[model samples]
Target: MFSSHSKLYRHASPGVQEELLALTSRLRSVITAQGVVRRTTAAIERSQWLAPAEWSALQLEAMRALALHAGRRVPYYREMFARLGIDPRRWRSLDDLTEIPVLTKDEVIAAGERLLAEGGPWLRFKGSTSGTTGRAMAGWRDRASIAFEQAFVERQARWAGYRRGERRAWLRGDPVVPSRQADGTLWRMNRAENMLMLSSYHLTPQNGAGYIEALEKFDPVMIQAYPSSVGYLARWLEEHDRNYRGKSLRGIVTSSETLGEAERRIIARRFGCPVFDWYGAFERVAAIGTCEHGHYHVMEDYGRVEFETNGDGTANLIATGFGNRVMPFLRYRADDRVVLADPGFACPCGRSFRVVERVLGRVDDAIRTPDGRHVVMLDWIFSGLFGLVEAQVVQERLDEVCIRIVAGPEFGHREEQALLLRARDRLGAQVIVRIERVAQIARTRNGKFRQIVSRLSGSNETDV
Candidate 1:
């Protein structure tokens, strides 16, 4: 298909595209059920493989090395260490870090300007995270950190049956650049026919149809995306046809949000693919990924995890990446909730990473009612309410929770009433529950949709 006189078209020949497509088809075939199961099982086996005494020693050594590195190179750490009158050389274990005091988001923000002014190390590249609260936080990382992050992701993919150089479509919130401007002609990432980049934000009814069309053309081996975006496309595909599985995708890898059972079933059924919900965050750098066995295994060798307790007895998860250098975060509170996996539980596969039952919710989501007499868990309210494709709980007034729901076609008066009954039972008789059918729910400026939102800025006076 290459024209003799044309230069760009030479690289875009039909034979080249066909060759890429054939290669991708082979890659997708490797993503088998047996592979996913082995990977999932391997996580537990790997963890169990670690001798307790050996693991503890390694963790302590890592912690000591990190503390010394931070104390010497990072200005903030140097100042903080001096303020605390601590000697970096004297610190030997992870427990010594507790004496350093916790660094809040405000402190990080204040120090950020100075950090940027310092221009960072030459080897480091700029990376920004929409921190736990969807607030912007900037940091720097070296090439090693980037490699480690890639390794963790690739390792998980391998476990899930994906091999290198496979063609997979990435559906992300961020749109790929060098996009087509003049016409409908789509540009593949690096002119690779097998890999297609689709925007998650533009997933409207019309755009979703277009997305399906693109998927048919790309014939990717796997579909990797956020659960919400995938759900939107999956539902659209199912509604459009009885058997709407895309031509290329054999499996789906979902991340960045809680994948409800209702969500998993819908996407799996609609796409005729297994949906594996991997858990990770920007703060922690893809720390954990779930296997087909539905167990979440931490990439333990990559990072150390710690559980902190609030006065209320709730557990908060903290992670420290041993890989990052430019801005090493040791025992950084990830602001996620998790419960430990059973100690003796072993998976048949042999890679060693600790497992987590599930990630409950974010730290800020649990709210204190107006009277201060009750605290409500957002997940409790959402427990069995996944029938609604999209939902948000808005606390604009005390004793009143405005529930905005985007209902599916199956949603009816009876479903609505059942939801109301559940809410009333949870919120109490005095609380007023308002239900509304809205075209769209308002997202935070950072483009994060909170399942539960509160306007109260630590103000409780509005409660009656």
Candidate 2:
């Protein structure tokens, strides 16, 4: 279980703050000593060396068990199977799963009450999405599912060379400090997690040095943050002719936002450490993490992922989670696009799991064509072109889009025509695509760079 400082601590006196910190540290130590961490570590050690066939067998067995439980215990799935004329008990292999219909976020939002099992041995908690796609939805997760998710995260941390109980710093969306507090401490100590929770909203140019100083004093062995948050600091240091290298940092782990090649290089150079990118969603349907060799490998045991080919060499990801039996997500559509690599491709890290070529942003990042098609990854329009430092695609309306670019010396009319032609070819001839050259693209309030911003607000009716 996770622990947080009480609200009373916010109003406590200076002496009480220290006392609270001490109490938090003690609580964290107790939680760490519990069997959760130990079991997770053991699972990671065993699964990493499993042969390909052995891993597949284990996953299939888990899938069959989950399907049986859902059909027997869960109200929604039991009724769904009956309505679709499917018998979960008769399912012999993974291929038989196609008889069931896919689940969507809209269905989860509309019929969540029917999704939960009547009673179980596990405890349940309510969780909400970040609403980055403009639609916020809530779901439930059982304690066992939560523990397993934490284990997978711990396994990823180990891949990044971080050990449990080591000091670390976090720069994410958590509001550790009040946004209005302009002059005081911008961070709080989560002594239980041994974490220095830094505020992502306070990373301004004037406060960059203060943040750097605090991190240096804390001497955290690893920093887990959003790519945009760390990228901002890296840019600030470069502009000021300063550096934060030669510290206690072992590696930097990034998530939440897409990490670009340029931003990765900048962060690695300034921090003197490798940057590992992790991709996952709150729905817990699928997860992909960067390996030591910088290739993304799907955690095959965590979830089952199926790709829906889009004929453009990209596919939408549909996943079924092995965890979270409280709200079983069967053939859930994630709406995220990815390019899958050959199944025979093997990582030098000796893992036999499948690899993903790239995660092309989310479906919400797509521009809608007049014929009702969503054109995703329009940023590729500027790919391989010189003199383009950064680009953003804004879909303000159904028929029009604005391409914002931060161009360098070599950018010219020829490059502009190329971008326009590429967009037009994907969006069709009637759509109006315009290019707007700018000094720099803007980031979100949480310091995230969104490649595609769609102003349209409505339900996503795309088929899985």
Candidate 3:
């Protein structure tokens, strides 16, 4: 399937390439959409009608199957299991999974090819993290795993009253529009997906009205956006006393960041729709989505999630993905902190998926450029920095920005120049870019690291 699509795309003209790409995207979406509907329907039925003990038994069965598969097929897991004195045959229950040590990002990076499954006839798709938390990791996913994730996402959208085939507006980190094109139409239509893709990097207070106008004209049934971008729009609407109440919008789906209470409320109030937030990563290790009842529910069928409780009443999320047989992530420490909801607590919507009180990671300020552009998720600026231990972007003023880097032995003038060039490319050349080599970058009082810190007035730190 991949080869056929690649051939068609390769032979197409530039104008035809866009259409072919959209066609392929839509084709994949259609295939995944079928699985999504089927799996989500079954999941809803099981969560709503099945007994708690029965649901738990199903999860346990799935976990055991995944663990045994990992032990037999994945080299890293097989060796780790043997070294830890764990017999895969005896791994009958979720409790036995603890015998395997938590898989850290560092461990995954170091393990390299050893973590991939052997004797795989399945196709693998390469994916990587955004490195927003200073630790970038890459991995592969099988087709089934990708389908399962899409199913979970579709289920979340359904929970928020969005039906399939609805027109939607998307404002995420994807560079769908050319950064240099500063004229008309800040958004492009993806006719195949029925989506209007807006540029996240182009949103500013001065240009926000243009975005709102585009959204209003698009008349989408839903908007899937990064929390920070939607929050900024909501803030603009509130300050200007403008409302988007009469649009076709039914709900807003936010992902790739922590949605704060304030941001959620503001977005919900301004858009006159429910805000559904999702938490997951490219690792496919875990997934948590918001329900209509305003609760975050962890999808147990997608992954086996374990919580490591901290002294401050928060817990670090560790997950084991079941569908990715090509590269199984067993007990992978996601490094995301979450406040675990009480086990006895139940949502009004009555889904049996476990609840997460909140995701407590990735809070950062939007970098305001000299041209009044607000840029979130600045980690992309430091991409391809091989020996960068950690980096932070701090905006002291609208025109002045400082980047602090903790470099390893391999980092030098060349890598520094690359980083500077990227930064200048994103922000205009007029903005002062100072690169400082530092021993370490400081964390917040809560010991969490932020990638972007803006000291500009009214630029509140937001997640994702």
Among the numbered candidates, top TM-score falls to: 3
Clashes of each: 4, 0, 0
Which residue window of length 10 is worst by lDDT in model 2? 1-10
Candidate whose lDDT is highest: 3
Per-residue error (Å), model 1, residue 89 = 4.8
Error of 1 at 6 (Å): 27
Off by over 4 Å in 3: 1-24, 27-49, 130-132, 383-385, 409-418, 457-464
Candidates 2 and 3 compared: the better one by TM-score is 3
Clashing pairs in 1: 42-349, 46-351, 46-352, 47-352
Query: What is the C-alpha lDDT profile of model 2 across 1-464, one tens digit per residue?
Result: 22222466545654455456557667544434346556766876788778878877777787788888888888888888778888766776677888878888778767767888778854467766522332335678865776777788878887888988999999875545543444457777776578888877566667788888888889888899978788878888889888895367888898877777888999988888888888887788898888888888888878888889878777778888887888888888885778878777889999887888877644334466554434543433554464566677787788898888887777788988987876775566657899998888877764445667777776332332
By TM-score, the better pick of 1 and 3 is 3
Report the C-alpha lDDT of model 1 over 1-464, residue by residue, as the tens digit: 12211233324444454344445444434422344334544543355458555565666777778777777777887777788887756766667667666555556656774433234446555555433343346676655555556556666665666776787877754323211221243324433334566644245464565677778777777878877777777788778875554575667888766666777888888888778767665544327777657677766666777667554444567767766666766566665666666757765554355666666544334333443322323333443443455667778767788888877676688878977876765555656898898877766664545666667666332221
The C-alpha TM-scores of every prediction are: 0.62, 0.74, 0.88
User: Scored by Cα lDDT, where does model 3 land?
Assistant: 0.78
lDDT of 3 by residue, 87-182 (tens): 756766678778888888888888977988898655677655545567456688766667777777777787777887889889987655555556
Q: For residue 205, what is the lDDT in candidate 3?
A: 77
